[model samples]
Target: MPEITYLEGIRLGLQRLMRERPEVVLYGEDVGAFGGAFKVTLGLQEEFGKDRVFDTPISESAILGSAVGMATQGLRPVVELQFVDFGMTAVHHLLNNAATTHYRTGIPVPMTVRAPCGGGFGGGPFHSEELESLFCLMPGLKVVYPAFPSDARGLIYSSVMDPNPVVFLENKYLYRHVKEIVPQSFEPVPLGAARVCRAGRDAVVLTYGAMVHEALRAAEQLASDGGYEVMVVDLRTLKPYDADTVLTAVAATNRVLIAHEGWRTNGFGAELSALVADRAFHLLDAPVRRVAAPDVPVPFAPELENAYRPNADKIATALLELMEY
Candidate 1:
C-alpha cells in the first residue's frame, strides 16, 4: 500500500512491533540518540524512550551477552550489529549461549541479532560478508535474509516475535538502493517458506537476499534472449529452509543453479546443491551448478569488489551452462 525502501521497511517493522509489544526492546551501537549507523532506528528512541530503545557499548560480545540475560529474564531484546562481519566478535554468544539457551533448558530466549550484511558499496573485508549459512547451520537459531522490501518488513516482525534466537540479515546493498510498494498491514511472513519470484520450466535458480534480484534479472534475460525459462526461488528463511519447494522446482526444471554473494567454498549454495542432488537427483537432466563469490575477502576498491561478488551476468552464464548441459 505504500512505497518504501528496505531500510524503511525495517524501521516500520520495528515501530509496529514495539508499539504492539512492550517487551520488545532494541539495543545496538549508536541505536539511541544517534539512531543507528544507517538511521534505521532514527526516531525509535524518541518514540519508545531511552529505556526501551538504547545504545550499547562498542563490544559486540557484551551487547549479545546482555541480550541473552535480558531475554532469559522475559524481555524480548532485539540487538543490532553495525555490520555482519563484526558478528564474529560475538560468535561465542551466538553459537553457544544464545543458541543453546532454550534447547539445553526449557526457557525460551526470544532475542534477535539484526546484522546488516552484503557489500556493493566497498565496505571491504571488515564490513562485508554473508554469513547466513554460518549461523543457519547452527541448530538453535533461525536465520532470516529477505530480498524484497515487503518481505524485509514481514520477516523482521516474524523474527522479533519468535520465541527463539533469530539472526536477521539485512543486506546493506538493498537497504537504501531497493524500493517497492509494501503492504499497509504488519502481517508476519512466515519463516521457512520459499518464494518463487519467477516461474519457469527450463531451469531453477535458488537464492536469497540481494542475489535474489540478480537471479530474477538473469531469469528475465534468459527468457528474452536465450528462450530459457528459469524459475527463481528465494529461500527467505535460511535456517528452516523450504526443502520441499526447492526439490519441487528441481524436479520440474530438471536443472538447478544455486547462487549467492558469499564465498563459493562452503557457501550456502553448497547446501542447496547437496539437497537437490540427494533428493532430486533422478529428475536432474544436468548437474546442479553454483554461482558465488570467489574464495577471497571483500575488496576495498569498487572495481575489484564488483568482480569479487556474483552478478546477474555471472548468474546468466551459470544458467546457460546448466540449461545447455
Candidate 2:
C-alpha cells in the first residue's frame, strides 16, 4: 500500500499490467520517446522498448483503426488520444467500429482508449473538453471517468482486462492535483458503480472528476458555515451508471444536484437527472439541480474560462438554492 498521486497511480498500474501481460502494448502521438504529453507513460519506452511502447501518427483515426485491428486479433492495445477534443476525428472508428463490434459479429473488442480530459489547465478549446457525452450516446461502449487516483489506476487496469471496448477519460486537472493511498493489491472497483464520497441526510451532490473536489468543498462549506448537510456521490463511470447507488442516496437526502464539466444542456447531467426523476421521483423533496459548464467552447482567457466551468462556489450556491427549495 502506497500513497500516490492520480497520475502516479495510473502510471504504476500501466507499468504493472505491461509486465504481467506481454500482449499489452501502449501507443500514442508522443508516448514513446516523449513519454506522453502528460508524462503518464514516462520511462515506459525505456522499460518496455519501442517495439511495445511506441508512438503513432498525428491522425487519431489511424491510431484507433490500428488499435481496433490489433485488439480484435487477440492483442491488448491501449491507445491514447493526446486530448479528448482530438477524439472527434476518430468518431467513426470508435462509435461505429469499436463500440458495435461485439454486437455486429459477436466478437469482443478488448481495447482501451485513454483520453486526457477536462479544463482548468488553460488548454483552451481544442485541448480542453469533456467529450464523454458524445460517446455515452453510443451503445456498446464502456465510458469511465474516475475522480480519484486509486479509482483511475484500478479502472484502467480493469478496462485493459475487459472483453469489450472501454473509453477511459482522465481529468487533466486532477492528474497532478489529486493523490491517495493505493492498496498493494488494489482490487478493481466494479464498473457502473458509484462511490458515496460523503454522507448526509439533507441534500445530495452527484458528480465526478474535478467536480468531485468542488462538490466536497461545497458540502464542507454548507456544513460549517451554512449549517446545511449535503451528501456527495461520485459517479465514477458515466455510461452504465450506478442508478441503484444514486437512487439510494436520493432516497435518504430527498434532494439532488447533478454536476459535471460538460455543457449544461443535453449533457451527462441531464442523463443523470432523468434517471433520478424516473426511478426516484417519489423520494425527492426538491427538483434535481444541475451544475455544469456553460453551453460554449472552453475559453483561453483565465477569467472567462473560470466562468465557463463549474466550481465549488457555484456548486455551493446551487446546493443552497436546492436546500431552500
Candidate 3:
C-alpha cells in the first residue's frame, strides 16, 4: 500500500500485534519514554502506555529472566536488547532456562527477543556483533533475520505468536538503508522458509540478514560484468532453516558461495556449507565457498569497519572464483 523503511516495518508489526493480542507486552532498556537506541520503538510507549510498553533496568539477565517467567505464565513478553552484542550476558537464561522450559516441564516460553545487530556504522565492537549462530545453537530457540521490509514486518508477527522462544535479529544497517512498498495488511511470513531473491544457473549465493542485500548486489554485478547469472538465496530463518529450498538452489546452480557478516569460523554460513557438503555435495561443480568478516572485533574506524564487513565486491570476487573452479 505504501513505501516503508525496514525499521518502520518492524514497528508496524509490533503495533498491530499489541492491538490484536492482549497478552503481548514489550519492555527493554530505555524503550519506553526514551524510545529505543535506534528509535524503532519510538512513540510506542505513548500508545500502549507504561505497563504494556515500559523500560527495564540495565541488566540483560534480569530482563531475560523476567521474560522467561512471564512467558511460562499466560503472557507473551517481547523483550529488546539494545544491541545483540549485549545479549551474550543473558545467554544462560536463553540456553538453560527459556530454551529448556518445555522439555523440563510442559510450559511453553512464547517470548521474542528483538536484537539489533550487524556492522556498517562505526559502532565499534560492542554494538556491531552478528551473533545469530549463537542463538541458532540453542535447541529450543528459533532465529529469524529478515533482509527486506516486508519480510521484517511479516516475520515479526509470526515470531511473537510462536509458542517457542524466538530471537528476532534486526540488522542495524538495514533499519534505514533498505525500503520497499508493502501492503498495509499482510500475512505472517512463515518461518523456516528461504526466498530466492535472484535466479541464475552459473552460481548461487546463500546468505541472510544484511549479507542478503550484498549477495543480490554481487549477483547483479556479475550478470553485467562477466555475463554470469548468479542466484541469491536468502535464508530468512536460521534455526529451522529451509533445507529443501537450499538444496534446490544448489542443484540448479552447481556452485555455491555462502556469505555472512559474522566471522569466517563457525559462523552461520559454516552450517550452510556443511549442509551442502552433506546433502548436496554430489550436485556441486565447485567446493563450497564463504565470504565473511575476519575473526576480529568490529572496529570503530569507518575504514576498518568497512573492510571488516563483507560487501558486494567481496561476494562477487568469491563468486568469480567459484565460477572458474
Assess each prediction's global lDDT (C-alpha) against the native: 0.92, 0.91, 0.94
Give the C-alpha miss distance for residue 250 in model 3, angstroms. Answer: 0.5
* Best model per lDDT: 3
Positional deviation of 234 in candidate 3, in angstroms? 0.6
Query: For model 3, how does the per-residue alpha-carbon lDDT over 1-325 read when each residue is reduced to its tens digit?
Result: 7999999999999999999999999999999988889999899999999989999989999999999999988999999999999989988999999999998898999999999999898899999999999899989999999999999999999999999999999999999999999887999999899999999999989999999998999999999999999999999999899999999999999899999999989999889999999999899889999999999988999889988999999999999899988
Estimate the overall C-alpha local distance difference test score of candidate 1: 0.92
Over all chains combined, what TM-score does candidate 3 have? 0.99
Instruction: Please provide, for model 2 over 153-252, each residue's C-alpha lDDT reduced to its tens digit, 9 standing for 90 to 100.
Output: 8888988888888899999999999989767777877888999999898999999889999999999999998788899999998888898999899989
Q: List the residue pairs that clash in candidate 3.
A: none
Query: Residue by residue across 117-195, what tens digits does model 1's lDDT show?
Result: 9998879998888888899788899999999889999999999999999999999989998899866886789999999
Alpha-carbon TM-score of each model against the true structure: 0.98, 0.98, 0.99
Query: Runs in model 3 with CA error above 4 Å?
Result: none
lDDT for model 2, please: 0.91
